[model samples]
Target: MDAIDEHIVSLLRSNGRASFSAIGREVGLSTNAAAVRVRRLESSGVITGYQAILGTDAPDGVAGLEAFIDVRLEPGRDSEEFLVWASGTRDVLDAVHVTGPYDYLLRVRVRGTAALDGFLRLLKREAGAAQTQTRLALRPSAAGASARERF
Candidate 1:
């Protein structure tokens, strides 16, 4: 992608609701030009559909315990089957297949340890999870530099 494309993506990443006119103001284009560029990006698969990031664990909008499950599978287990199960499972927020000792890494959220216990148990029964390791996210202190901010 070029500089203008990068700028558009960065703006949307921070706030998906930004309008064509708003984006144009930041990137030196008119609303019609901005709209055309965005449409082209979407057609070319650079800009996927916008989505809302809703609160899963918090009713008052404060994020709660974010955790990862390092999942090891039994010999000859079907990875696709496991992934399908993981994705549809209620408590699972995200699942990734990655290279390492573990076959999958599951991101999850729950109210507390008791809720996590129940979620893990279901995971074990479904996949016969050979060995599972876990890590809990404490908090994010830094917002970090963005793509636009980097340049």
Candidate 2:
């Protein structure tokens, strides 16, 4: 990709809904030229797809819930294997091995209570979790609230 194409990709990464005319103006191309290049990028799979990112609110406009689960693996279950599985699980945001009664702690977000129940069932059935203790987060603390901003 040329410099203009790189710039276009950068712009689109920041705002996927940017118009061809806006991209053209920023990249010094005509609107038609920008459209053609963007189409080329799409066809070539450089721009695979676009998606709408949901905020803290759920798709239904209700606020989602966050919880932390303390997990104890089944007898002879491998910690590395559990870590890998937890990493791949969609709702699991963070998993850490800690020195405590539990083997691992998992931070998760779910749309509602039903989703949380389903996730716990899946964890026990597929992830080899023998026991779990869960606590819901009422709100983010000062540090928790600013954690994402640091990134």
Candidate 3:
């Protein structure tokens, strides 16, 4: 990808709903040209998908909690099974297989501590996790912030 393509990606990352015209204006391309470039990025798997960033409070006025769960699988456990289960889980926002002390890192969202506790119990019982460490996120950085700034 060229510099223009990179810039388009940055714009899209910050605002996935940005119009082609807006992207074109920012990147010095015509609207059609910007749309074509975005299509190319999508076809090449550079842009896999778009997602909405939810606030701490939902539209229904319920506050949500976020947590990161570090899980270590038992020896001889089927890692694929755990991965598949985590992927299909409703409260699991994201799961990554990592090269570290933990076998997987799970980002979870729930309504309350009771819900989190229930989810953790289910994960341990069903996923065969030998151990787990859960850390509640006190606050998340602004969604519009760049990755470097958030980190």
Better of 1 and 2 by TM-score: 2
Give all TM-scores, in the order shown: 0.52, 0.55, 0.56
lDDT string for model 1 (10-90, tens) is 999999999999999999999999999889999999987997654333434444456899999888889999988887876
Pairs of residues at least 3 apart in sequence or in different chains that clash in candidate 3: none
Clashing pairs in 1: none
Q: Which regions of candidate 3 fall more than 4 Å away from where they truly are?
A: 1-62, 147-151
- Model 1, residue 95: C-alpha shift (Å): 0.8
Candidate 1 ranges beyond 4 A from true positions = 1-63, 141-151
Q: Compared with the true structure, what per-residue lDDT tens digits does model 2 show for residues 9-99? A: 9999999999999999999999999999999999999999996654364334445778999999999999999999999987888999988
Candidate 2 residue-wise lDDT at 150: 48
Better of 1 and 2 by lDDT: 2
